[model samples]
Target: MLNAKSEIQKDTFEPASDNLSERSSILTEMFRKALFRNRVQLVGGILFAIGTPLIFRFGFDQLPINSSALSNTIVGSIFALTCGFFFFRRLIDYPGTEGIAYAIPIFAVTYGATVIVFLFLRLDYSRYLLGASYFLTVVWFTCISIGMVRLRTLRIGIVPGGSANALLSLPSVKWREIREVSEPTENLNAVVVDLDHSFPTEWERFITETAVSGTPVFDVKHLRETLTGRLEIEHLSENTLGSLNPDHMYLRGKQAIDRVLALLVIVLLAPFFAIIILAIQLDSPGPAIFRQKRMGYRGSIFTVYKFRTMRAEQVGSVDDRDRAITKAEDDRITRLGHFLRRTRIDELPQVLNILRGEMSWIGPRPEAVPLSMWYEKELPFYRYRHIVHPGISGWAQVMQGHVASTDEVLEKLHYDFYYIKNFSPWLDILIVLKTIRTILTGFGAK
Candidate 1:
């Protein structure tokens, strides 16, 4: 148990462990391939960053004439690059006007920062320049947003059976432009067929022809993974689990970075931490900190910490499954507790866990021991997420929001598997940024 807990405390820049040496050689190639896969977006970002200021300078001399052209160009360039980063990094391309909503906050911050800098320098501010830049950005981004929606739209034809029904029912389908139909259409971008069930010769020919034509044809199970960002548990097998080769270098580096970041955040938020402690103590009779045994890396059990958000209660047995899950309207939550959970102030104490080497700043969230034991019994390949240290925030938490109940856990596992298989610094960065949005919006909080 101690060995497992200490895995995180190891030097970040050093090789992970003896166990990882065999895999390190291939890990770099895999990450290089994944991170560089979005080369078009990368190139586009650079071009826009360099080109936007020049175009604005030509069209509207709103830029401060006295300031160096380079200095005047910095704000708009930063704003464009920042927007493109978050917009293009998403795994699921949100469709339609709703997709634009995601960029609003990013724009506000970057643009606001630009204005603040101008005021700080007491430079001659040009309202025309600011307004012109804003107008040009909206027009530019609107076109790109439409293109993104169109690109995400996949005209999929699936035989009516197996995973088809479930795929159609998911709310997540709205994130992409997917249109599933019973019959194969000439315009289909892809085709999904269940291998378990037999289809007519005509259907087989349609699938074969689609493949021949270079339109991608996918197995129903693989399509589920692609669409939902989770491994489909119903079809999970040993072969699938065995195929996962986690990048040890990336994991170790992420851990080192997480610890350093957690320490810095803890130091910065120290004043807020004291205020929270006092509030929790005044609002409830229990201790300010709550700790419970959670399944950690390699199934090691460790105590996880959080601010107390419920009334004082005795610890229960591992078999106490009924009381294990936190419900949406749980009455034991105090007035301050409700506020804490909504804003995620309740989780601030977990920085200690990160510092202690039991958790990362990002990964699969740890499940309580009782809940973990129950899931192990109920779900196949449930323990696979424990391949890495549990996290304070994770892919599932940001994408699916807070989950409860067996059905939700099953769904959450899909995302967890996706994270495990696709682990990269880019995905972790996305999770962290989205988590901030989730916290501010009070999304999925009871």
Candidate 2:
């Protein structure tokens, strides 16, 4: 039978093994992750947008401008602000008008959701001009999305000013030169780069996040020979750059924002929060509020609080990465605590952490001490994240969704840097609004 089959066909086959294919698969994953952030961005953008109307509806019920006019003005202002931020895409092309497309849709949804929710809860759309707000948001996003699709700004180039996100963050990508790059997506930024070089997925993620204007991109072949000094991976070709930033870390402004936000949260959520605390006491034999030593703002150790989500027996069962990072159906989670964790009510206890000067309203999340030290020893600027104070929600939480690997930490750090470099009260407010949406959607709670 073997001889007959061999004589009949005599064909030998081998599975595929191409370096470029390997690289492409890795990077494509990052790109997909990066693009997913837009979901959060979109939701956050919508909340701030729609929430504005709710505020105005409450505040300016008797105002000079009509609801439609007010919505248009705010949307116009948002478009105007974001439009100017573009570089190569904005300059020669329809930069200003393009981003309006995304802005408008998000704003529209936000206004609709916000006004509706407020009306449902508070019964006061009398002030909001919901129709006008929704119209403006729709119009704005339409314009912005059109511009983005045309410019493909998020699709190519060397990106900066945000987290060290995976290249996959961009919505779509197709290789102009398959021989040069393997991944499917890229950022469209001011930095003109030739993808005519190969890079590993981790390095590709770093370049998308940390490679800045002055850092010269080396041809893959030239990296070892031409580049000198402590060869920053940012200067290397996409191929040589490894899986992810082992050293990626960030610290945002901690003191002032934390104080204000924690106090405010405690005051606002006090009653509901008390019940959560009570539920924790009923569920297990531990403190209702679990306070554990964590690495914070620059790796400094501090106690971070939460309503104990796990049983006491499970407390030491799993490590932080395995145990603490919740999945969709983690059994370690308690019954009442399940609702709390899903709703992010478990985090409400952290407002006390903010009050205690351990974290900010927004920034990188605090790592457990052992995890922090372990990462620091292995990672390249892992401790740099602590340059500022830790935050409750920062660039990483909203942008990257959740952390799973050392590679994710590196990717997230790029985003943390972007937020830190451009830290502002406005950004904090934006994050807070986004946090609300995250809680509602439970986008990355797992």
Candidate 3:
């Protein structure tokens, strides 16, 4: 087993081709380094997108330039490209960010916002220039993404033992097992070890030396969580629970934003809401709105609202946990319910809950009363998820979908815990993107 494992490690981290002696010119080396730096990429891409247009329109006199139009174009293009660049950069730091797939939509949103602002202010702007800027922004970032993927390699050295071996199965990283303290570390981006396991004196010294030399040392368990986007909790402790506490300022700020946005949405979609209500009443022969008591923030039970999708006569007892769980293709779901549930349009009414401070736009999904009670009893530290206000859409909803079985819910709990552990705007943004995809694909819908 040892020999076979060694063989696999050898194949995984085959040395790069011996071409180090062939040094390029000084200028070329500097250019190569600068090309890979993210700051350089951001500034350079913006300049290329904006400068090329200015030079074409004014420098070459290709088109008659109006000063107001020129000024608006320059400011708008810079704003859009800069915002898009940073947004893309921050999102890629999180797990599950699809390479280059977000480029077009992100740029579209930034540029679209710029256009909205322009129209709102009734400012003159050249559509052609802005359009070209948008196109070039996507193209430049796409090229940068392709180049980085081809040029960069994440090679991690593993100190073989305990859970360290578990990370070897994860893809998107080159794993090299360090069998001896004498193993080379120059090529590795970082080193990982099972910190919970005792190490020999030499291996302990090696870990110290590696860190002293400026290489990052990571715990195998934490690294696994980072790579997999799940946090496994086997026991409860203050240190463990302490780390899961979200930023309170962001929490408060998020609540305010959620309510404001909810108000805006309710006002904007009022007409559409009426139409859905009428349709639901006609289809299901019951109240257009379904209200249920749900387990909410800090163990509070709150009334949650949704467009009625299930048949009225099929309503089950509130104490029945089984009925609270929506099974796959259940007969209780009305025809409109299928579409509403599939598209998550059923969740629209929950904006009122957000307005009421019982929920946010994103967080853990609150379970029905009985299911929540059952889970708290069955799952250890399950109530920890209530630290933040429940969300209309959540990390678990986007990642794992709707789960009914206790075993499946256990896994979903891990996802929820992971969200709480790494709670921030970036993760929320990623969830929002994933939620969009989920809606389109009808994933995790009952």
- Give me candidate 3's TM-score against the actual structure: 0.87
lDDT of each: 0.67, 0.52, 0.83
Residue 113's lDDT in candidate 2? 53
TM-score of each: 0.71, 0.53, 0.87
Please state the error at residue 119 of candidate 1 in Å. Answer: 16
The order by descending TM-score is 3, 1, 2
Better of 2 and 3 by lDDT: 3
Can you write out model 3's per-residue Cα lDDT over 1-446, one digit (the tens) per residue? 11112111221232334564434444444554565676788888888888787687668655454578878888999999989987887776655554476788889999999999999999999898899899989999988777655555467899977789888899888889999899878767678999999998989999999989866788886777766777878897888879899999999999999999999999999999999999998886989998889999999999999998899878677788888888999999999999999999999999999999999999999999999999989988889899999998988898789999999989988899989988898789888888988999999999
- Of the candidates shown, which would achieve the greatest lDDT relative to the real structure? 3
Name the lDDT value of residue 417 in candidate 3: 90
Question: Which of 1 and 3 is the better model by lDDT?
Answer: 3
Per-residue lDDT of 214-306 in model 1, one digit per residue for the tens?
A: 656667776666555666655656877665657899988888988998999999999999999999899988799887889998899999888
